[model samples]
Target: MNDETAYKVLTGTEFAALEAGRFEGAPVDLADGYIHLSTAAQLTGTVDRHFSGQNGLVVVTVDLAALGEAVRWEISRGGQKFPHLYGRLRMAAVTAHAPLARAADGSVELP
Candidate 1:
């Protein structure tokens, strides 16, 4: 993935809805109130290839801190506990202006 598409930001409620229906049975991680979602298929494909096959899935992490109070409320409704929204969200690839990089500490660092 390129810089413009490397990161995708979604509201908690939106992610919750997507997770409840579409991403059922996918692996999820919640840490520091943030939700990280990944699917086995996505992890094994292009996204995984871009990430050096690290997780074998396309992972999307939603930061709770980035959500508004109303969004959180909506996401938690109906006794539906929220899980990390992870999956292979497919999109058209675009040409990148510059290359992406990783820091010495192994964190992705963009130019």
Candidate 2:
């Protein structure tokens, strides 16, 4: 969870799977009933906690405006507010994306 609204991060394979008109969601997302997105500050923790050791990852900056009502800010880990998409993520909702590469400090840079 984070204080600011930042971009989302996903693996390349996950992004490819999102190519379908409706992104059903990742395994965790499906189990949780929504798409999980991480903000800039939370990105590193997210990667280390969930996506570490994974390659070909991408940082996606999605259009929250496009998501409209589908996006909801809710309290998750550590009681911080996080954006959750209750519905399928449409491909058109994404605005930008880039490789998830770590810096010398081991933190990843956003697209």
**Which candidate should be chosen as best, given TM-score against the real structure?**
2
TM per prediction: 0.21, 0.85
Q: Could you tell me the lDDT of residue 38 within candidate 1?
A: 21
Clashing pairs in 2: none
For every candidate in turn, the CA RMSD to the true structure comes to 12.7, 2.3
Off by over 4 Å in 1: 1-21, 29-53, 59-101, 109-111
lDDT of 2 at 46: 78
RMSD of 1: 12.7
Worst 10 residues of 2 by lDDT: 1-10
Once fitted onto the true fold, the runs of candidate 2 whose alpha carbons sit more than 4 angstroms away are: 1-5
Q: How far does residue 53 in candidate 1 sit from its true spot (Å)?
A: 9.0
Candidate 2: give its CA RMSD in angstroms.
2.3
TM value for model 1: 0.21
